[model samples]
Target: MSLKQESPDESLKSQIYTFCRQIANSRPIISVCLCDGSMRAFFGGTKALLEFLLIIKGFKPRLMNYVRFFDDRPAIFYAVDRWVFEKDVDVGFLGEAFAVHLIFPYTPLVNAGYLRAKEVKLKKRLILELLENLVLTFPELSREIRIKPEYFVYESMLNRARLFPPMYNTLSHFFQNEVCEQNFNRVMEGYLIALKELEKEGLVECENGFYKISKSFIENFKSRKTLFTNLFRSAQKALFMSLLGAFPKVLGVLSERADILLKFQFFEKG
Candidate 1:
């Protein structure tokens, strides 16, 4: 049973169970992703972002009623959980999905003239998660996947274009310390290779300096998440991890779009 878009609660729970059952019967777990889009679909709006998050985090559900993001992109948050993957998480349905949500190799923000802010990280994690899923599902690419660690660095930097303008320095200052000239250039080279690999797999369409993920990738990602595993964790849990570390708004998707539930956003649209 292939998975479809966010559906009614009945369809969501049924499909989720089916996917989980399959993973349980398979080999080592591969990938686990979270999306902001799925969160909106499940909870219905960003108004509940904080409320639902609190509930999931053992907070008083009613007390969280005041939290809200109210951004764009269906304000949906979604993600999937995989046990062990060989390489990438190319759910095809990359952005707006949780799989590509938490992993921001660099700062993530969507500003004027820069639509794709998290492209680099998105590509890297998407491929890694997808490869992981495929490896667990197909058992091939296991060795090849490991050989291309550079693939992630390259893919994660491709979307840096969205770093300027309205977002300006606000975004760069956050990640500037993490990336220097040497390391940044290395990541750029990796981005090129990763883009090449993605194009070969029909995941994205690329021009001279710009790139875009194919709709098929999005659809496949949704299907894999729907038909394969259950989403137990969320961006909220991952980011706002008070027990572990401080959770800052490094990834703008969570801030720009409020409907996203982070990790727990993959429930059939309720």
Candidate 2:
């Protein structure tokens, strides 16, 4: 199948679905060659690759029903029916089945680009704060985990935006000081000190200079749904207040336009 098919009005979702369908029809374990111009043309650039992943994540429930993504590096590998496959199978028929199943009957109200931006800025910040709070509040877990400051930033970048993983240089460049000098190391040192406390609790582990959050740790936290819900609500309220306080113009505009407030209420209710 030629990958050069063009659709001027094609949305990102359609592009991703097409790419995945092509891979599913190929070998059981297909490697998408990003170095080739075809994949780049489909995705636009390396940054758009990240955007593609984020967009796919938004459709996780639907996609997970048929196929599952293994990893993004080297190339994206997926299995048709199983999460892991030992050998290749004839999946040409399955690809057609997926094409029929994955059809979008109507155009999406929000495009992938806007969704990605919103998620990176708001959803990612909330998640990072929650993770930090989790580590700090649980002393036992803290003692077990040892994480570098960079991990939080990298994880946040991955979670919020599709930006590449934070490397030494990227971190340094992004977090420059007032004098235009990088002080990421110093900031990272502070994070490491906090993470070290968690490391003592035997909950955290460092593998090849990267701190890893264990599955059990996440499960444990997830089990405490009530606590997390309360914490999340409090955080949301605090964030809203902070934003309002920071932008007096926004507050003034909202006050002057009561209809806008009512519209927001209607949106929240819906």
lDDT of 2 by residue, 213-236 (tens): 665566666566456654564454
RMSD (CA, Å), candidate 2 to true, equals 22.4
lDDT of each: 0.34, 0.34
Residue 253, candidate 2: C-alpha displacement in angstroms: 17
RMSD of 1: 18.7
Question: What is the Cα-based lDDT of residue 5 in candidate 1?
Answer: 32
RMSD each, Å: 18.7, 22.4
Candidate 1, 1-270: lDDT as tens digits = 112234435654454434433323343222222222233344343332221111011122111112222333222211122211111123323122222233332211113112132345345544545444444554433323222344444333332213212222223522455334433453354356667777777866665555544556655654554333413222332332332111222323354444343442333331
Looking at model 1, how many pairs of residues clash?
59
